[model samples]
Target: MPKNVLILHASPRLNGNSQTLAETFAAGAEAAGHWVSRISLAQAQISPCQACGYCRGHQHRCRLEDDMDKIYPAILGADCVALAAPLYFYDWPAQLKLAIDRLYAFGPEYSIRDKETVLLMTAADQNPQSFGGAEATYQLALVDYLRWRDRGRILVGGLNEAGAIEGHPALIDAYKLGYTI
Candidate 1:
């Protein structure tokens, strides 16, 4: 019953608080004997979607061949997908958004629906409302678009400095979520 999990870290900073939370979640998932793979979008050369509509016509395959080409297969094969990023201007970083948009390739035609997904995020502000937009996007774009069952979400606020999530309660919660997966 080990699920295949993919964690997409969208933080530009390698050790950013969000990335730390992602690592914590991954650790928990691994402890639970789930297969996990973590990919850092900040370090990867993922191209933005070109609205070419080629993928829509061509079997859910993106036309522009790049790192996205590499990621597409993983997305299809995953039993669970986790999107991790820091809140930026009440939304995810552009890199993450672009990568997400590109996933449009797997539109309704492909039937990549009913998978499981989790979202993990960190922000400088502690306001619970600060992450609404980003959370909404994940719900609509990833969960609804792919018809994935929502597993859960971990939103950590008031963490700005890099690695600030270390030893935080949210980190512990993330670990538990992963382990429970």
Candidate 2:
């Protein structure tokens, strides 16, 4: 069965290591006959969510009109979501977090309760603990809030320069993860 996979690339740099990993994963997924949509948050005009309680009051929809509206439907339509980014100051880029926050408008019914989620990240530090904080954030915010099944996580560390993840062992893992999905 072909599954719809949403890849959210949160790096501001176009050719960042994280984006490279994301592209590899997307390619593997496509080779396996899955549909993949990669969205670059840096290039998109996504606004932050203002907690007006409007979505909660009005049937799980946001009042603010922006790029987020377009993403809402895509998320609802996706069978799986891959959050890809380079670790920044111990967490995801601000834009990615913004997207995740805005997704709260989808409400419980439209939430990713049964959907699978994969977290892919690259870091300059070689230590595994470098990504712990960011991973914990996803585990708490996305996994717990949306109640999604965790497919797996791929973290490539010690890649400071752009596109460094291309030759990393984690790239192989990411490819396998995508193809298996």
lDDT of 2 by residue, 32-132 (tens): 99999988887778888898889988988898988887788888889999999989998888989989989778775655577899999999999999999
Candidate 1 — which pairs collide?
A: 114-147
Candidate 2 stretches with Cα past 4 Å from truth are 108-110
Q: How well is each residue in 1-181 modelled by candidate 1, as lDDT tens digits?
A: 9999999899888988988888889999999999999888888888888989998878888889788977888887889989899998999998788888887788756466857999999999989999999988888877766678888999989898897887899888899999998
Off by over 4 Å in 1: none
Candidate 2 lDDT trough over 10 residues, lowest sum:
104-113
Q: Give the local distance difference test score of model 1.
A: 0.87
Model 2 TM-score is 0.95
lDDT, each prediction = 0.87, 0.87
Work out candidate 2's RMSD over C-alphas: 1.2
